[model samples]
Target chain A: MKVKFLCIIALSAILFACNTPVTESEKNGSEQSRKSESEDSTHVPLATEKKVELKREGIFMFYVGAFEAKKMDTKKNPMLENKINIALDSISGDVIYGHSVVAGNIRPFQGTFNLKDGMYTVVAKEPGDNKYDGVFTFTLSPDNGTLNGVWTSNDKKLAVSERSYDLKKTEFKYDPSLELDGTYSEVYNSYNAKTEQHEQITDDAGKLNASQVELTSKDVENMYRRDLEIMRNAIYARHGYSFKNREMRYFFDTQVAWYIPVSTDVTAELTDLEKKNIELIKRYEKHAESYYDVYGR
Target chain B: MMLGLSTLKNKRKYSLLVLLSVYTYFLWLMIRITLQYFPAHDDVAFLSIKQDYVGMWHYKLAFFIHVFSAIFVLLAGYTQFSESLRKKNPKMHRRLGWFYVIVTLFFAGPSGLIIGIYANGGTSSQIAFCLLAFLWMLFTLMAVIQAMRRQMSSHRAWMIRSFALALSAITLRAWKYILVALFHPKPMDVYQIVAWLGWTLNLVVAEIIIIKKIRS
Candidate 1:
């Protein structure tokens, strides 16, 4: 009887957790609600009255969701998989316009963003007379300026589709003096060289900084770039890019749950993000190419 | 602690006071976090519904279960360790125990596991949280089983273990703060490390409590 009682109690708790005041009719709409009217896709952001503030500026990256492809003069890439790097000006807080290797080649883009009343709408337009546009809906993080949301293509040229997004601020450098080697090492050698020339100044600071660290203008830039690279690499691994083995596959196994395309087939159609990620990996490949040629694929 | 209580062992009395203090602080902190959702801050997963797409509602539900049920879990579980409540108000003990068991098994553990599958830290953090949830439910079930078998001591031991797992929520935040102060490590690193240590530390403390009882 006692065992039965305890079991019933446990069952009741489970039932209670599963139990919401939502009616059968609501349950019917739960499917609709999940596919939010915007995305018309499988998932939707929960609507809440919450507001978030975003004022800091750096490299804020976004996961591109869906795009309506138009077989126009320019090749239209439908799905962007990896992440779009947005370099926001710290002082102006505006997204710095630039071209990234997107779709098949370097695609030019323009965008406008607003932070008001806790809702974010970022508009991205592929630069041309006839432009493919993406309107993103974002929610600001309560702890940091991270924004998470979904976006859909609104251009008449493409299909109206949507995808989810994961956006967060990373330690960002406006620029990094990369060494062109597959590896991006910090540009501290020059700073160290400069400090060596000013040995007297270095000696003065060495007394305070017990570790005898070399301060460089690239400190913030290098730190952010290092973090950004890790994120990029993780995303690359997530999209099925094996880096020096299967280590990246299990990187976040401890912190986040990842479920995905469980097929071993690498012949899948790549997303726009994956294409861009492929462009990035080519750099590593270029350096490692010589090594791989000597060894194998 | 009830502030002016007497007739308890020194360790239980002091420990209860510490637990109450920490709990009160955690309650205030969580409440402050919940109320400030209007203008979401730039961190924490408090309002993921706003920008998240598609299946975000499930995450919201899981988070709600983890949050709301935790309130009752802490309050009801606190009274369970009260000697006076057990002796003078035995009926209340049983009722509160039922509430504790129900909320944990149904709401807390299951929801925690569901959301933990989507843990932000990736793999390591996911494993830690999921394991914690599973162990939480297991310990509570064992407690209930022992209680049914009329093994009061064994039941109490399991309850101690169960409560220790529940205490992870408190320790998670506490350890985050300490680790941040010590080394300004990245947030994910802190989360990964503290996620593992949070419940493990609590279980150790619970083991100490159990060992003390057996020795005395």
Candidate 2:
């Protein structure tokens, strides 16, 4: 009876974990447009609002490199590289409104667009709800199609108060053919605390494409924990899903060159094959016994 | 002379107590490992890859029977091998010995054989497990027959062999941990190697012990 009760609790937990609310994308789209339409007529007009409307609207991903202040030790605070995507959802005249997607968090930003002497410059400020919120001052060069500039954090006391970025205009499209390449061979993240070691994933992980093929136990039964994890996340990375897991973010942002941070939740974007493969991979992942020079069954 | 014999007996008893304590600790660890399968989820631990077999009713039944019975056989087998218990309470020793033999022959061995056919790591591990289950049942049966025939020495030898095969449960996991820690082999590669090594090494030790006894 006790075992049965424990089973109920365990089964309930598994059920809860598996339960992802199927969001109606159509409903969300209509609701968003309705909200925006209601706030359209505010009776506030700027000088250049009608004259200079920025035609460039989409996701511009910036490769940000943050460094410590000169007085601080460079060795201790190395140049931290990360990618943030600026999504220009609405552009009306001189005022451009959008959200910045970075490190699995979305911050709504609004700023002014100015075109002076054939060089387009923009100053965007993120909503100061977060401590790490900052202002992005950047320029888009028509010749190179790149957005380059510096981001100054609202909190000056932060170790990395300022970061510079060079962004390229990239469009996100789900390509099922995308597979884990050789760049993902070395894991820069995922430290094994018990063993004090990091994983060097084998090439076997690259052999099978979780997004393309339906996986069988024979295919994944022998894979290491890190290998399985990489294979599983490769599906998400392909969909431009910003990972909340720090280890996943570090791995994807640094290694996967094509990965674009777009949305924190991409459940609705997952293909049926990808969903099945995810379930299969997760089953194996839970069972995968990673070696760390520690006692295990 | 009596005092000297008593002291030597006490020393042997102390050593036996130490050995039993160590065995008990390992048994506790094994129990914890077994509990991970309880309220048995299809994707639990080793069952992760055995989804193909886990779906089959016979395979599921056999797996649970083998897992649940193996623990008792392990605990009961230890008591049967206790020299002081055998000497002082032969009746109790006989009962526990019969319990171990019956459980192994009727439940654990057959169920083990059933699951071994579908064992992971493909053909190599399957063959190893099947052979292990066969040998386990065979040795235990031989032990029972020898006891019935009053062949005390041979019964003890056969029981030693049978118990060693049973110890494969623990030794296999130990070898897996050691091998993976040192070599970092792939999961199935380690499984294939440990599947054979788990029992073969124990049988070799059992033979050594048996030969030492005969010589002594």
Tens digits of per-residue lDDT for model 2 on B1-216? 999999998998688567765666566656655665777766665676678888899999999988888887887645677566578779978988988998999999999999999888889999999999999999999999999999999999999999999999888988988998789888889889999999999999999999999999
Q: What total of clashing residue pairs does each candidate reach?
A: 45, 0
Count steric clashes of candidate 2. Answer: 0
Candidate 1 on B24-62: residue-level lDDT in tens?
A: 556545443343332423222323212232247787677
Error of 2 at A287 (Å): 1.7
Best by DockQ: 2
Question: What is the Å distance of residue A200 in model 1 from its true position?
Answer: 22
lDDT of 2 by residue, A1-297 (tens): 423433354345334423533221121111110011212122222234322333333223233322113222344442366667765555666776766666666677779988876666889887776777888888866456577787788887665677777777676788888777755355655468988977777787778999999999888888887788778888888887766565666677777778887666677788899899988877676656322233444
How big an interface RMSD has model 1? Answer: 18.8
Model 2 chain B: which ten-residue window has the lowest total lDDT? B24-33
| Residue B50's lDDT in candidate 2 | 78
